[model samples]
Target: MAAIRLLSFLDAGPLAYFTPLGAMALFGAAHFSGYVKPYAFPLLALFISDLVLSFTVFAEFRTGLLYSGWYWTYLAFALMTVAGKLMLKEVTISRLIAATITATLIHWLVSDIGACAVENKLTFAFYLNRLVTAIPYELNFLGGTAFFSAIMFGIFELAQRKYASLKPAR
Candidate 1:
């Protein structure tokens, strides 16, 4: 979790709008079998990172830890967990790729609602422009999720190979 949280902050900037947030949620949800705590892992990591950035890197834009977009954005984060567990239930490479794309698109759509609401009046054209402008950031975000998803699953598989105890019995 610390590693995930730190990795998120390492690339903080405009380009970082597409951090490993989706991958973190997806990996946690797919790896853990639980109802409550698994969901909290990514959500909490997001909130903590938001808090840290609010005070440090992004302090210029935000006044405090929690912001207006938090509600919508966190909702999207939680949805990624559900999407992860459902789509990546089998944990295959194909499913990971699919989930990464699905989660990223859903995230882009849902999260933009907050950005549009806060920055512009709700309108079709405004939303359309927001989506168009968001393409580059989404690409960075997509790349980050793919890279980290590979790392997360790869490391887990490697660890299981080294220690039989780490592998869950079939």
Candidate 2:
């Protein structure tokens, strides 16, 4: 009991520190609340973070302060979120691995398409370069999501064991 409590506390940090991880907690919470909308939390998190990130980190990449390209990029996020919600259903190693791949691929394709559209040029080389450059970052994002998702899911499972009422029905 004491060990589970300690792990739960530790899980809180990872659960909140990153946007994706935080949404995983909300996903679990929503499951506890009742019907799992699945994509709700992840979609919300991705949309908000993409908006903020485009305006801040990659703001200079485009002309305007807020890149209109973000909307397209977010479409991919929504795709992956829906995939995660619908296909995964339960948090497991296999599902997390699959989600990581799906998220990376979706982001790559959408972002590259946005790149071509925004530049007003449809070029294969441009998309190829974008895909190559995006690989490292996408890998990192996937790794982080898997790591934190596992932590959050584990912690939640532990909590449910102790407090049965908190468990989301199968």
Best candidate per lDDT, number?
Answer: 1
Cα RMSD of all models vs. native, in order, equals 2.5, 7.9
For each candidate, the alpha-carbon lDDT, in order, equals 0.79, 0.57
TM-scores for the candidates: 0.86, 0.68
lDDT of 2 by residue, 113-163 (tens): 887787777788987887787666566556555566666667877898999
Clashes in candidate 2: how many? 0
C-alpha lDDT of residue 68 in model 1: 54
On the 0 to 100 scale, the lDDT of residue 77 in model 2 is: 57
Give me the displacement of residue 92 in model 2, in angstroms. 2.7
Superposed Cα deviation of residue 125, candidate 1 (Å): 1.1
RMSD in angstroms between candidate 1 and the native structure over all alpha carbons: 2.5
What TM-score does model 2 achieve against the real structure?
Answer: 0.68
